[model samples]
Structures are given as structure tokens and as C-alpha cells.
Target: MRIAMIAAMAKNRVIGRDNKMPWHLPEDLRHFKAMTLSKPIVMGRKTFESIGRPLPGRHNIVISRNSQLSIEGVTCVTTFDEAMTMAGDCDELVVIGGGQLYQQLLPKADVLYLTLIDLDVDGDTVFPEWDDGSWQLQNSVTATNDKGLQYSFNTLFKKC
Candidate 1:
């Protein structure tokens, strides 16, 4: 399986605030849905709760230490390794996250599909700092939505 990250971050690497996205970009949301459809997506418990339910047409694998917590339609695991094992045979393992979950699995990912939003706003959850030295940009495309939100879709690959 190919592990990958799919997230939207700001210039300051801000991902969320109080369990909600800091920005509103419909195009990016649609792009995210398009890319993740029919794939197995791994996410932290917080991220899963933020969305309020399991995303349809995909397997929802959530990471959390609370063994007693149960979410309908989601397979819950305690660690990143467990999540990996549960996603066996999946061609693509998409990491959908809040913050800490991204930090834990970013190193294991082979590719990153990042939506770089242009604005920076106050946020509590932030994406972990990655070692750019070990990765290279594969491709990018800049676009503006109907709401005038400027964003870039960037793909990065680990330097092999």
C-alpha cells in the first residue's frame, strides 16, 4: 500500500481551530472528496468527530487510544501501525487528519497531496514541520475558487 497525506494547510501550516477548519474553500473540499472517494482513509479520532460521521464510499479507519469509544461505520485503532495493518491491500492509504495524527504518519508516507491555501488565520491545530530535505516537489497547480480563495494543489514525493 502507498501511504499518502491529503490536507489543506495555510502559509503557516495551520490546519484547524477548535475542531473546525479555519478556512472555507468549497473547491478544495470538492477536490479532497474526489481524491479520497472509494479509498481507505486513516484519520485521528478528533478529525473523525469533527466531520460528525464516516465519509461515504470509503473505509474509515480512526486512530485513538480510547478502546471503549465506538463510532458507527468506522474501524478504530490505537496506533499508526495498527491503522497500517488494518488498511492491508489498499492501493492507497490516505491520511486525513487534525494535526498530531499527521505528525505521526507523515514520515511513513510516500507522497503528499497538499492544498496550499493562501490565507493565514488564527488556528490551534497545526501540521507538523516536515524535513523538506528528504522530499522533492513533483507538481503543482494554482487556482482560485468562486469565493476568491486562492489555493495551490501541490504534490510532493520522498527523494528515493
Candidate 2:
């Protein structure tokens, strides 16, 4: 399966604050939903809780060390390998993550769908720093949010 990552972060790489996204960008949210619809999405426990429920029209595979954890309509796994094994039949495996998961699996991903928010904000969670030389930009589209926040949805393919 081809692994891909999807995240929204500030220019400073802040993905979240207090267990939630720092900014409200509805357009980016819609973009995420559209891109991930019907795909198998892997995420860490914190990320799942932050979302509070399984996202409709997708397979939710959550990675957590907690083996006894179970959620209705969700599959919980103990390792990334487990998640990958379960999703192996899928043509594309999408990782929608919290900081730790992104840091651990970014190197394994073949594509990145990133929403680069224009403003910097204080946050407790951060997306990992990746080398620009390792990813080739495939597409980008910029748009402004209802609250005047500007952001770009960028798709980058990892260099082979």
C-alpha cells in the first residue's frame, strides 16, 4: 500500500493546541474530508480522541499502546505495523495524525497533503520538520477562510 500523510499546520509547524487544532479553517476541514473519504485512515490515540468520533465514510484505524481500548466502529491497533497490515489491501493508506504519529511515520509516507496556515500561533503539538529536498511539490491552491485566515492546500510527493 502507498502511505500518505495529511495535516494542517501553521507556518511554524504548530498543528494543535490543548489537544485540538489551533485555528478554525472550515475549508481545510472540507478538503481533508474530501481527500480522505472512503480511505483507511490511521491515527494515534490522542488524535482520535481529539476528533471525538469516527469520521464517516472512512475506515478508522487508531494506533495506541493501549491494547484493551476499543471504540464502536473503529479498529484499534498497538503499532503502526499492525495498522499497515490491516490496510495493506488499500491502494492508498492515509495517516491523519497527532505530533508523535507524524514524527514516527512521516519518513514512511510517499505523499503529503499539507495545509499550510499562513499565521503562526502558540501550540502544544507540532508537526515534524521534513526536508524540502525530499519532497517534490505536486499541487497547491491558496484560499482565505471566513475569518480572514489565509492557507494553502499543498500536495507533495516524496522523492523516490
Per-residue lDDT of 1-160 in model 2, one digit per residue for the tens? 8899999999999999999998888898899999999999999999999999999999899999999999998999999999988876889999999899999999999999999999999999999999999999999999987788889999999998
Write down the TM-score for model 1.
0.96
TM-score each candidate: 0.96, 0.97
Model 2 alpha-carbon miss at residue 46, Å? 0.8
Query: Candidate 1 regions off by >4 Å?
Result: none
Predicted model with the maximum TM-score: 2
* Pairs of residues clashing in candidate 1: none
Model 2, position 104: C-alpha lDDT score: 93
Measured by lDDT, the strongest candidate is 2
lDDT by residue (87-151, candidate 1, tens digit) is 88889999999698788788898999999999988999988888999999999999988878889
**Where is model 2 more than 4 Å wrong at Cα?**
none
lDDT of 2 at 35: 90
